[model samples]
Target: MSLAIVDAREWQNLLDLRTGKKVKDDDPRVQAPQTATLRDVLRRHPYPGDSDPRSNRWVTDSALDLVAAYEPQLACVVYGHQYFAGRYTPMTDVQRKGMMEELFAEIDRFVARSGYEPVVVGTGDMVPLEGEIDLGKLEGLAISSHWSARYAGLHRATPRDLDHVRSLAKVERVVGRDEWLAAFPDAEAVPARVPEHLLLAEEGWTFVTTGTPMRRPVRVPGRGFRIPLSTRLGAAPSLLDIRGLVLSGAAAGKKVALIVAEGVGMNDFLLPFTPCANQTGWHYYEPGDGFYLTLSTGRHQVFAYPSGYNYLDETDEKKDLPFSGYFLDFPAHALGDDFPGKSVAAGNHSMFVHMVFGADVCMECFARNLYNQGGFGVIHRFR
Candidate 1:
């Protein structure tokens, strides 16, 4: 099994006690050297572009625009931390849906191009997705809590939820122990849904997933012991038309999300069919009430800031255009907000404005002017 641990050291870095417990931007404690850690992992993989195994890390894609970048044809598996990396908050259900929707859309493209499916297992965090799934009509449902079983230090599982999903998916056939590995050698035995042999066809690369038939345990801060949750809320229920709902967003015209790690050795993701960049390249909202058309219940305030149009310029090369930035604050209900008033949730408090890259706005030239005027990094494109 090709196992790639993403942000393992970074996770450790953030969790380190010496640092403040919370991981956030502007925190200097977690800023230890990460390049070395990234390079060490990439060394094991085949390097593409100007291949040289001796050089531990791969080249930065600038904006993650390069293709034919990776050398290995292996399945490009991505592992991410749920609480921090996944960027979830307790208050927003829309953002939670958007996050997974974005992830699924990104993975679908990778699967189509690379012929390898992206596996999304758990990363020990039991933060619910903040959304609801209707499973009353389904025959059963199965939920897998952790990512790859072998890679998890703390064993976590959810069997009852798995059975619910199985009922909903109408899954039949549980592979017996004797023929399980032989039939589906590559597939991990998931305690939910169909058995190993039942899932595999005569030939096809298989992905194995397993979950403990137990509720995930969660610890309340300042509390003494961990409590078992009924089910993993993040686990999406498999439905009859599940394929249709899953693939609808991948239809077309969607701007691909390109994730790049400058010094970190984690592989960059060239995700097409992912959500388009926000007006300022920060927030992604559902287009409409329908799966694809749903927009956010509230709009972000940062979009009101003037976005920089560097693509308007013709010559400067030193400045980096923002493909996307981070959120300054979650939406707040106070005045000076633009989100729909009907929304019970507060308006977006603030957002990170990412400048457009390449020749789109001639931003390269614009950035030089902005920097010369000592106005660099100020949102200005909207104006």
Candidate 2:
């Protein structure tokens, strides 16, 4: 059953309230009216399918109902352009404040009607909730980062290279390997010798860096490239091979599946990672305690917490992080004949799964930025 009714007219009013300007037909916020079910909406505008969430014209009551049905115990509602219009467009400070107020009021109304006391979060104005609330306690679900796979790319960075690149900038993250090498041309070997594991297919050529310290000192530019690196890299690997399976259904047993991926974010709690989780989920935990992913199928519930730490962080007390390895009572199913083909259909998203055999593996994968703005989530429901 559907949970709530979402009318485009209501959305238009919210946008109007936030922007304090009448939305004209030409306005990007203005979308045509075409009512449909949440499933249909998702099917038409699947993650990595539609570039703009607002363009779907189906972010109405049906979408909310779908989410509410999937997670009935949901106690928090994070409203953003995904909820109201779409993200990536520009907005003024006044508009942002107005949008936050509108979202809060709408969430309050939803709570009153549904009897679900959900914490309302404005993507633009996320503040620490002290002792009153813990976002981690709330299921980290969001549609904002459900980006199309077309824009997705796997960034690669080795431990030493990443450190050298990050040292050149004050920001916590860099764009990709090329940008780092581009800014520091000397870092790029004339012959281009890179570790076998780090070699990318697109680059075509590879160069080896020699020396005992493993440090190839190059002439530093007088001024570092001040521009933040592009979060999107052309030569990065593709996540299309990553797959999800329901080894044990939430109904029969706790959901379990074998996940084969290149790396895991230090602050990331959930597997089959999402960009939004990386961007916002980190704030939910303290230094030591990692994040959590709770799964349910109306009859049973299972929780997956981070049991291992892997990633290169300069500020971290421990310098060398371990290679990614995870084992759990609720384990990930191995990819085999039973493995569901190259792609698994989830809601409206068609997640493509790739299998890596033998020794060729990616150990150091880049953590993507919010700019890609596209990601996919899967809820494996087994009978």
Candidate 3:
């Protein structure tokens, strides 16, 4: 579910996800209408899917900026756009740094006017609270880092790099890992990398997961009926293992497709097609706390806010940064980079199949300025 929203339309999903029913414009449940849109984040990219946010990156910062500009009598400016980029385009260094400045400026302006806390964060903070999975707390130490690299920087709405995120405030907590591995016993030892802007844990929301970290079985609003995550990751397989399987299958001249059905666990997997194993699952915090990085390269990774797409990831091809690595150098280590056969990546989730996992035919909506609309497409065919 989208944690933050400006217009009433965005709120409908929250209601729909809960009830599994269509919410009408006049539906009392959905109070926000097009007329209620806080700010018109003019779409920049033009494509069939461009209008639908699920298939493209929506200029989310514009909403936050408008709210900050409103300077309401009572309002909090918590900046975080890096989570659940259902679909997106990468950003270049110039684009990322400039927009990041705009994001921080909005927060700074709001704080100066209202004197309220500026909350910025990662996906970890919301995962547990999402109501789908429950994440209990574990122990931990110092802070950690994950952000890395710049891609086509075209179609995604998530921050391409988090380089400027840390500069916005007085540092406190350092980087580490998450709260979910309570079942493992070792997760608590990993440091928690809560960024300065995030304060949900301090507010006592039972500290779920974060763009900051992941853990426990706590719910966001409340648990749903059919959706659930497999905390019982029995013989959990690292995604890297799946990568190997795909390669082997492809080599055998078999048409391979890796379908990642979100929210559905191995226990809940009841698809008609039989998979390699009867029940197979993998946990996210394999090497450390991260997402796409863990998928492309089976190592600890994070995006740049705290990253600017640099720091701890092996994907940063330009090892110019002190912290970045060159694991992508060895195509075999990364998933799609070295696929022996034709690999095509087309998905709503940003930066994954296309950027993180290299693709031959990458199709995504054109991502331009703050917002865009017309009839332009961003499709890359790298044969």
Candidate 4:
């Protein structure tokens, strides 16, 4: 009993409304005669899968940009021309493996100067490497599906298989499709820039879902669905600025993970912990009370509250700012608004999860940002 909640036509309708591009109602050219539904749209625009040929041109740029926005420390490469890709290509499995190896080495060199790690994102097929890559030694990593993976007649990777590959790489998520492959009426092709502009324009709706079963909030068969973020974008609690902590060692010892609330923004909460003090990094305090910093040396430090019961600000008499070994900071940008206060006409719910770490350092600002997005509801130190 799968639920069909969002419709693909909604994608076109929302695109038209946001861009002011007039798409005909039931226009046969956009493939309307057969009445393509949201499920059909979803199939075509599968999650984690590469975009269709028509949609690939713009999506690649958007996808690369999206990865860069979050993982600034990581680098990438875009391979395979649109026309020459797909399983039917004359390339052999060994030849493809060699191609990937060469590409991976190039990314390694790019990050070598910066002392960061690079992960290769590809379009189709999830190949597992027999050896493990020392991710901690590298800055960060990312891999994704290629556009050719979405072709109607090509061999594409499945989410289940992708999930397995992610586990091998210790990655938790993969952007992928929600349903099977679909077909639609032939009409004016959706411009490559449409989806990118819609997201950037903030014309669609954003939904938040919490503590619900996976795949709930089923959509109506024909309506389009919304892009459900894992966390929210509300203003976070103010805390000590983290820009100055300036840890001298490599980030190899510094750890960070995502703590997301269903349908919320990505930076909802980032908590790095250490058990040097209480064997648990969870900070507990009463309302209006200041949070103490417990150092690895067993020393206790205190922070004072501002007049408004928030973190210490200018008006507070406490001249000393207690340095919490951990720091917190909000993401620099929100999805932004379409035209100001207009609800993004989206059709899905959000997903939520908390970040748990095993080590700790100065992370006050980082923790505060997470708590501000949506109070840190859960804390776990291990996966």
lDDT at position 96, candidate 4 = 44
lDDT tens per residue, model 3, 114-203 = 343221211221222322211122122112222211100111112322232223232222222232223224222222222322211211
In candidate 4, stretches whose alpha carbon ends up further than 4 angstroms from where it belongs are 1-88, 119-383
lDDT of 1 by residue, 1-383 (tens): 00111222223122221211334545442232332222233233322211111111221121111122222211112212122223222435565445444444544544355432222221122332222223233223222222111111111214554454345332222333335334324333333222222221111111122332232222111110111111111222311122222223222322222121111111122222222222221111111111111111122321211111111232243332222121112223221122111101000000111111111100010111012110011111111
Which residue window of length 10 is worst by lDDT in model 4? 343-352
What TM-score does model 1 achieve against the real structure? Answer: 0.20
Better of 3 and 4 by lDDT: 3
Best model number under lDDT: 3
Cα RMSD of predicted structure 2? 20.5
- C-alpha lDDT score of every prediction, in listed order: 0.21, 0.22, 0.29, 0.20
User: Distance from true position, residue 4, model 1, in Å?
Assistant: 15
Candidate 2: tens digits of C-alpha lDDT, residues 31-66 = 322112222333333233222333122222322444
lDDT winner, 2 or 3: 3
Which should have the higher TM-score, number 2 or number 3? 3
lDDT per residue (tens digit) for residues 28-125 in model 4 = 32443212332233334322221122222222332233223223221212222221222223456565444444433433333343333222112112
Using lDDT as the measure, name the better of candidate 2 and candidate 4. 2
Cα deviation of 329, candidate 1, in Å: 40
